[model samples]
Target: MRILFEDSPDYEMVLGDYLERIPISWSRDESFGLLKTRLVAEPETTRDLAEKVMDNREKGGELAGSLLSAIAETSEGQDWMFESLTSGNVRKEASALVMLLNLISSITEPNLDHNLRLLKANAQSVSEDNTHLLLWCLEEACEKERDIFVPLLEEVLRTRGVPAASVYLSRPSLHRERPVSALVLAVEILEEKGLDNGEISLGLIGIYPKNREFVLERLKRWISKGKFPDSHHGMLVAHLKKHDTSPIIALIEELIDSGNRNALYVAANCLEELTQSISEWLGWCEKWESDSNKEPAVIRSLLEILSRLKTYEASGDRIRAIELVQKFASRSNIDYEDSTKHISLGKYSHEGCANTRQENRYTLKRP
Candidate 1:
């Protein structure tokens, strides 16, 4: 088979014929040994053979399992498999890699420590298409060896960024073993790249309640540096609600003061999240009203916050929030015409007040 793979003009078709004959003509152990040798010498060929075996297994060929097991046990076979992962540059070998990972994962006695180390080493060259394969292989290997794989997991997260990194970090099973390392790597990625995607941000926030100080502090630092994107503010606020709202409230206020449109948008969402606490809403409204140099952006954000309040059930806090909106609007020299369109203070009138009792009934239209 090895000679055919190297020397034959029509190697692929001949190799396919040889693979089909292995189960019928050879003993299980001999077939396994021959496939392993072929795998190390010609990975791409063996990958084709392995796929044939897998397809045959689906049809009840028992020798496929033995072939895969032999490949998993040999160091050379593992190396060949990893090499096959990166061999296709133009189009990734996704199907073959998936089969390879499945084979490696099925071994009852896998050399996971060595395999994980090799995976970590290979992870440095990962491209977009092969990332999922690498992560799946890492996850399977890590399941067998946590202590050895955790650092490698962090390395993969650091090198691959969030889309792939989130798979390992977001898994509930591995959260207890050095999750902070993954969190810190995520923070570093955020600092370097900003919130290009929400996967890492959401992953961090998903684990925030568990790792409060570390996650919150990093979130705050990212927000302060203008690292987080505006679109992500809503997700951050939603997760922040699970922890103490005080720091999150303070962060939102700071963001409102930053005069950033996205930050103010996030602040509005955060305030809406905090609106269940009327005192906090009232306090923020009062604070914004007292400031003489309220930026139009801040005022607009404040108006959104007040408009959200109109949705609250009729309570003293709701009334105070409405009054605060009117006062803030008046102080900002926003007339009834302007206020009605943007702030919707007309909602506070008798007719408007009557309709505020229903859940999510009030929709704030900010100009």
Candidate 2:
């Protein structure tokens, strides 16, 4: 059955109307093969056909086959398009490239390999304007067709150097699903290929705004998998907000057990959200201090949490606060020396940073 514009529905009509002159038919399947044929043929209708397909995909719910194929046609010499896309000559053309890149991503590879090839080839082109867009497409490609695209992108990264790939590595949607694998691989590439810390941090944070549970799940997986060690500190801390008490508590306890000083600092800083009552705060301080025998990090993290929560938790029942903190802190060495002394230091310490003196005072002054 021939698909005609007038007879077909709006989605098919718009696409058909735009590509009327192109000598192509839209089959539900095999659009990729056709696009490959047309790309090799170098037909003048190629870009128009690609644009129409994207238009249909963007507006219609489903992406067009031919448009997807155009992205997949990865033969040599197609690198020029990446460069052409970045030039200011025709905004329409550039926009069409972006549209095609955005729309074609929905099609799963081996169909995606075509666009990946184009991106890999053009990744190093001197097109600063369209660079971010291309990187975004690569990020999506990594998500949709990870097996096919990651190696290619990695190779492209190695060739151009890891710094160039920072943009692609950090795209958020790429991390919307199980991002641990990508983050691990990305951290490896940055370290092995010599990317700077700034670049790595930027990419890591790209995945940070995802849910706390999501991050926690990935963190556990990463630990189990035993990779990406040098990065999680900043990533975890950067993600901490005032409302993250549960995870912060669990993380602090874990770090204390693990004996990682840096993680301890981060975990302690995270607790700064728990400062509701002196008793509750100091009670926890006493327990952890009792168990650890003068380990400053645990005490510090507890104090920080308590100090921050002071006013927020102050109106709470004093006796209840003491019982809660005391109950929670009951398990350990229970050091109130510093926390008590620093209770009056105020929860907000400006830039002086969290220290033993503040922690000690915070614990002692809590009546």
Which residue pairs overlap in candidate 1's backbone?
none
Question: What is the per-residue lDDT of model 1 for residues 134-175, given as tens digits with 9 covering 90 to 100?
Answer: 666665666667676667767777767766665554444422
TM-score of candidate 1 against the unseen true structure: 0.50
Clashes of each: 0, 38
Estimate, for each residue in 41-69, the C-alpha lDDT of model 2 and write its tens digit.
55334444444554554422123323333
lDDT of 2 at 335: 56
Per-prediction TM-score, please? 0.50, 0.43
Q: For residue 143, give model 2's deviation from the true position in Å.
A: 4.5
> Pick by lDDT: which candidate is best?
1
Predictions in order: lDDT: 0.54, 0.47
> What is the alpha-carbon lDDT for the whole of candidate 2?
0.47
C-alpha root-mean-square deviation, each candidate:
11.0, 12.9
Error of 1 at 3 (Å): 38
Candidate with top TM-score is 1
